[model samples]
Target: MANTTDDTTLALDAVKGEHPTDIFSLDGEGDWSPHITESNLPTKIIWSPTMGFSTVDKDVLAICEEAISELEKAGVEVVVNDSIWEVNPVESWMVFWACARARAQQHLIGTEEYESIDPLLRLFIEMGVTMDGASYASAIDACHHYNYQLEEAFQESPLIITPATCGQPPKLEGDGFVNGEETASWVDFTMGINMTRNPAGVIPVGNLDNNLPVAIQIIGQQRADLDVLKAMKAFEEVINFRERAEDF
Candidate 1:
């Protein structure tokens, strides 16, 4: 389910237990790859930066290869390449800022809204979530690009299978979450899907030794939410995925 072009696929390497599974690569299938690398990153990430993280984790790549071997045995076509897919994290940040602004404004003007909202609004204000006009325009362009590309891609391929996260879910350090690369790393796979406004859902595949579960994310095109859910059901049946987290 991982793209050879994306290093996040290496996250699968961290899985514990048996790694038996089918793997296959498709031909000319950058069909699922959405390019989002540091080089082409936005000049200003109103939320945070996407740097300092290694592009390719060798250990993770090795683990991904093993899983692919099993998938190939299952008659899946795995595409092998080193190209990057296009994605802009800023688009989602724009959406986040819009929501934050709406919530903050509601709290300021209305009564009996969510309690302690001022503190949350203050945090976002400090983070530059009230982006500039230029930034908002750029984000709008990015969203259009995403919708166009994703819609076109769906015409060729109805569904895309990918790792749900870069690796095992991390337990929070304390009461709050980390705000930089650490947080970005976890959503590396799902973020692009969010930007594209595609419907994506994850189905459990297996569990790590720490008892954290791993999943395979299934994504469908815009306005195809039902199709995506239907595909998830079919895939779960095909994999015989269970509610319980089983050994890898």
Candidate 2:
């Protein structure tokens, strides 16, 4: 939501508030300081090569590796751990996401409002409404299991790194290219984290051959937003990517 760690904190503080109807909002108060000073940099972090995917584009993988090398040169230990999640949580996450969307928009089904919705979103709503409650419960169970796996990973290393996206930015009106294939599912890297509600940050690591920027995802243990920001700031300093697109 912001260009820098300081800006992120400022934006969050401005909008963070309690609402009687918003049950999901955090209930208690705690320190929000980013603690991004040089002395507070993470000593060790985990890097998942494929980010729980079957394969990632070779160029994107190389960019992540180069970022890891830079962090190592800055005295941070980068541990290679490909098997972050034993059971891939993408399917379960999709089921849960679809069901949530259905719950919110199901009332409009068969109405003119429904016809006005985008076709892809209408498909999602249809998928959600047809899903059985037992399946939804199963998805919830699977998500809990995945959350436990992430908690274990956090115990070993407070932070985990992965490619922010599977490949370069997609065209404005077309699917993304990954591993030489055009696909719409190029964003699976962040699904598990979203399903588990972990705190994640992204920083521009480098630009692709086409001049589009590529970034790495730094995910922290649930509720460890400050630590994630600290790592992002530390790594941001190491990479020092300050170039702006000339057209912008």
Q: Against the true structure, whose TM-score is highest?
A: 2
Cα deviation in Å at residue 244, candidate 2?
2.8
In the range 152-206, model 2's lDDT, one tens digit per residue, is 8777789989888886678887777787787766676777888778889898888
lDDT of all predictions: 0.47, 0.80
Clashing pairs in 2: none
Against the hidden reference, what TM-scores do the models get? 0.56, 0.90
Report the poorest 10 consecutive residues by lDDT, candidate 1.
41-50
Cα lDDT, model 2, residue 120: 87
